[model samples]
Target: MTPRIVILGGGSVGMYTALRLQRRLRRGEAHITLIDVDSYMTYQPFLPEAAAGNLEARHVVVSLRRVLPRCTILNGVVDAIDTSRHEVEFRPHKGPPRRIGYDLLVVCPGSVSRTLPIPGLAENGIGFKTIEEAIHLRNHVLGQMDLAESTQDERIRRQALTFVFVGAGFAGVEALAELEDMAHDACRYYPSIEPADLKWYLVEATDRILPEVGPEMGMWTLEQLRHRGIDVRLRTKLESVKDGRVVLDDGSAFDTDTLVWTAGVKPNPVVARSDLPIDGKGRVRATPFLNVEGYDDVFTAGDCAAVPDLTRPGEFTAPNAQHAVRQARVMADNLLATIRGTRRRPYRHAYAGSVASLGLHKGVAQIYGVKLRGALAWLIHRTYHLTKMPTLNRKVRVLLDWTLALFFRRDITALGALTDPRREFEYAARTTAEPVAHV
Candidate 1:
């Protein structure tokens, strides 16, 4: 019987690892099966572009079935892992749970948005993580513009035009910048709404934003955002959001129709459900080789695993796409080495700086100790991410989208009906009589 390898999560780490393993293993040497809740893995770096309608939603996601044809792809959630029995219980998308034993288990379930217990957040706040969220946010923003334009009441108009975004990390900053740019561009279509009428706010609990790019760059980012008329509130905390009224810890209060949350992420709770050796922060305790502690047959990587950083003593690798992608390569090679009885190389890669896009033709990057800003940084950001995007087909599609965007005006059409497609049909069925009744 061939060795059965089960990999969990279809995110960057999981898909990359499976691809690497497939290339190294011969037929029947190992049977690789990948399981994920979603059929496609999202390229999170392009989420801002997707939200801004700069790239088609489909182009930013990689289909597991199309990319990993040789591997057994299961669209399911890993319900439980019984390491003693070397079996995993999986809950498929539309069926009862099933069990499959594995010779090796690779856990990379990735992370979920970390949220606070602020009032009304569960119902009012939107997260900036998945493709669905990005699309919804685009529609929602446009829909808010529609609402603001149609409303005659000053209070309702103000609420509809006001937008609040929490967190100032890369996700938050890029998302705000891109969406704000899109909204500003979209204002041309709405005769009633001027760009100045739309109030945008970025609130951060810390004094600085974009900590990944250092203080000088963070300050530059702050100045750039403020120059665009965005209210950047530092050392501020969201106290509550009750009844659509936003209350800040600094005694500021506002009513806004849009509230976006992109604070941070925590390891998937599924890791704790398993019998894996987890760290204090609820991440799988992974060695430098990306193998789980005290488990020879089990391996973990990505946001779910706390892999030690050899270059930085007493610090684990930062949970970012850069680290996740590179770790997948190293993890795959190390796993093969372990199986083949060859020397395993430790996973060690120094931080390679950061890049962030601030709307169109505006960005900031720090690469190899060299810093960049403005249009140059934006160009590099696009070039780097374009090359990093998985699969040639996706790359071409994204490039085409960008090329088309240069000539055509931004599409601000909102498809709010998508959220509830049956609403109009149901209303028509109730109000309109069937023509067949005449027969």
Candidate 2:
């Protein structure tokens, strides 16, 4: 029998590992399997653009089956890993639990949206991680405008136009910038909507936003956002969103219809379930080579794995697309080396800098000690992600979207009804279709 290689969580690391393994290992040398809850591996960097109507939502995600043809793709979440027995328990869409035994296990379960216990947040706040959430937010924003224009109630209109985003990291800043830009542009189509009528608020508990880009860039970003009429409330914490009332810890409250949470992320809960050593943040502890501690047969990578940063000595690699993709390559080579009895190498990388897009023609980037802003940064931002995007097909389509966006108005159509196609079908079933008289 061939050696069994099973990978959990088909995110970037998991998918990339499968790709590299397919290229290196012979067809009959080893059997590789990839498991994930979702069928598509999302390019998270484009989520903001997808929400802003810049890129087609579908184009930002890569199909696992299409990308990893040689590897057996398992569409399910890994519930638990039995390291002692070399087996994994999985549950797929209400199906009974199934166990898959493996000789070598790779855990890259990825991360989940980190949420806090704020009043009414659980019911009202929308997350910015998934494509579904992005699409939903787009519809909700547009729908709020429609509701405001049609309704005669002043309070309701005010709430409808108000938008709030918590956290000021790259996701929060880019999302705030993009949505503010999109809303401003969209207001042109709404006869009754004034640009001032839409209130865009960004709340950051820290002293600055976009800390990944350093202090100077962060200050510049704040000024740029404020110049665009966005309320950048730094060093402020959100107290509650109870009943649509946004209460801030600084003794401020406002009624708002939208609340977006981009605070941060924690590793997938599956890591905690396993007996593997985990950090306080729930990340699996791994050496620089991406091998799990005390378990030679197990390897981990991406956001879920705390692969130590050899360059930094004590710090683990930061959880970002840049690090995840790089780690995946190293993990793949190390795995192959293990199989072939070759020497394994350690993972070592330095920070290459960061980039954040603020809308159509605005952005900030710092690379190799060079600072970039405005359209140039925006162009660089697009160029970098385009190169990093998984497949050539996706890259070409994203480029086409950007090219067409320059000539055409952003598509603001909110197909909220798509969320529940059955609702319409049920309505039509009751209204239009003639009932078979007890046939």
Clashing pairs in 2: none
Model 1 collision count = 0
* Residue 394, model 1, lDDT: 98
User: What are the clash counts of all predictions, listed in order?
Assistant: 0, 0
Q: State the number of backbone clashes in model 2.
A: 0
lDDT of 1 by residue, 1-439 (tens): 7888999999999999999998888777789999999999999999999999999999999999999998999997888899999999999989799999999999999999899998899988999989999999999999999999998999999999999999999999999999999999999999999999999999999999999888999899999999999999999999888889999999999999899998888888789889999988889999998989999889999998899999998999999889999999998998788778888788899999999999999999988888899999999999999998999999999999999998998889999898888999889888876554654
* Number of the predicted model whose lDDT against the real structure is largest: 1
Question: Which residue pairs in model 1 clash with each other?
Answer: none
Global lDDT of each candidate: 0.93, 0.90
lDDT of 2 by residue, 301-396 (tens): 998988898888888888999998988899899999988889889888898999999998999999977999999999999999999999999999
